[model samples]
Target: MRYLFSFIGLVYSSLIKLAVLFNPKARMMERGRWKVWGKLRGGIVPGGRHIWFHAASLGEFEQGRPMMERIRAEYPDYRIVLTFFSPSGYEVRKNYEGADVIVYLPADRISRVRKFLDLVQPEMAIFIKYDFWPCFLLELERRQIPTYLVSSIFRPTQLFFRWYGGAYKRLLHCFTHIFVQDEASRILLGKHGIDPVTVAGDTRFDRVISVYEARKSLPLVERFAATVPEDGLVIVGGSSWPPDEEILVRYFNRNPKVKLILAPHEIDKEHLLQIISHLRRPFIRLSEATESNIDRQDCLIVDSFGLLSSIYRYGQVAFIGGGFGKGIHNTPEAAVYGVPVIFGPRYEKFKEARELIAEGGAFTVSSAEEFTSLIERLISDKGYREAASRAAADYIRTHAGATERIVRQIIR
Candidate 1:
């Protein structure tokens, strides 16, 4: 099984190398690891007491952020080592201040794992969400390292619970403890003999709440939000993809009175132009919006990153994107601001989205018609809108403290 896993890892590496010729992201993954071990040796002191945290991508990084910050505060002596499996996470957060050393996780092979383990000598290993490399887990267990999986969610369809999943199931046993996001995940793990599972909830709730409370004031957002007339509305379309934008563009066309803050997931020039071409209303890019006349535009197209969370403050209603594509982006980011939220129908995979919909804090739309109707109703009916807003905020408040719970257990 180990040999088979090693073969699979080699195949994966080869495929990435081939993909690099055409795919920029694949190129990044391959290029980011160039001389990685040398960089690791330079940054990480030998024999250092390191508390290592690994996240697959940006979303997982955010999920693990609260725990990283908490550990840094509580255990100042231990050096923090953060690793990312994807360039999407590593490239964005390579200079993150919370970790002492941030690097890309090398491919999972026995030799690579041994060299990494020998170099870092991590006191503890923490894996965020579901990026489990079998060889890495096995090596960590072999060295008697106390490894943990935090904010984990498990579904019955995962191979670990399957009849022919003996090899995969062994990986779960390597963890000293598993902190899951919900009771269903706990029960799933328990069925497979993975004991000591705790329903620690999702740490992202705590992180989003903190972001909301400490959100920076953006003058441009405030200016644009002010343009919303007394009876009009400001709708924030966050992390929007092309499909999500199409629906929003249709809605905006029908109701020019309502203002929109469109923040696309990717802001490359080509993509930006694509969004601009679809909009008939007068719009200005956030980068170009100034204090003097920013309020004159009917739409604000955000051309920058890192401001979407703060921009939610100006929205009376939020349409979180990515739902029409892979999954929904963060709903709690907007929900924390007491805004009624809406997303595409493909949000069942996101726990917060589902819970918010159940609580009447959010709604899901399958088509542009559904989206138009929902937004129009919410804007026209103040009582229903306010009820949704309250429910969204209350749901966030109740789900917070997951970080505190997980940190207490880690420190103990």
Candidate 2:
């Protein structure tokens, strides 16, 4: 199994080499790893206590952020070394101040992991949700490192739970502790004889709450939303893709009373033009809007990143995007702002999205008609809207404190 895993690792690296020619992300990743050693040598303090944190991508980083910040604040003696497996995460947060050293996670090969552990010499290593690498984890276990998997959830369909998964299941035993997101994950692990697991709700709830508390004050965005009359409603379309924009822009153009802040996931020229082509109402790009005339536009297209979560606070309703494609962008981000969140049908895999719906805090629509229908009801029925809004906020409040719980166990 070890030999097989190593061979697979070699093949993975070989594929990345071929992919680099065609994929910009692959090119960046390979380039990043090539320079990781230099970054580590310059950033890492010699003989210093370090806490290493790894996340697969941007979303996982958010899931682990609250805890990372907590560790940064509480354990001042230890420096944080954060690593990302993908360019989407590293490119966005390479300059993150929370981590003392930020770099790509060197490939999960045995030799690579050995060299990495030697240099970082971390007192503890933490892997964020669903990013378990066998070789890396096995090396950590062999070296007796205090490694943990936090905010993770396991399902029956995962490789570890399968009958032919003996080698894969060994990866679970490498963790010094496993902090899961739900009771089901814990029970599943227990059934597989992996004990000492705790159900730590989810760190995302805590992260979103903190985001709202310390949210950026986007003046122009606030003014754009403020332009809505007392009877009018403010709708925020967060991380909207073309499919989400079709529904949102269609609805926004037809209704004069509702103000839509279209914060698309992709702000490229092509996507922006696609959104603009569908808009009948006057809209202004956020970058173009200013204090002088920010109030005139009914639609504000967010042409930048890092503001979508904060923008949620200005809306009475939030339409999360990406559901029509891969999955939904952060639902907790909108729900934390105490608003009714609506998304498309690809939400079955997201636990928070499903729970939000079951609690009547969120609604999922499969088609444009359903989106128009439900959105209108949410806009017209004040009592129903408020009830859903309250439910969303309550869900966020209840699911919070998971960060403190996991930190208490690990930090001690």
On TM-score, the candidate that comes out on top is 1
How much does each candidate deviate from the true structure in C-alpha RMSD? 1.2, 1.4
Candidate 1 runs further than 4 Å off: none
Model 2 C-alpha lDDT per residue in residues 311-367, reported as the tens digit of each score:
899999999999999999999999998899999999988899999999999999999
List lDDT for all candidates, in order. 0.90, 0.90
lDDT of 2 at 302: 91
In terms of lDDT, model 2 sits at: 0.90
lDDT of 2 at 186: 95
TM-score of each: 0.97, 0.96
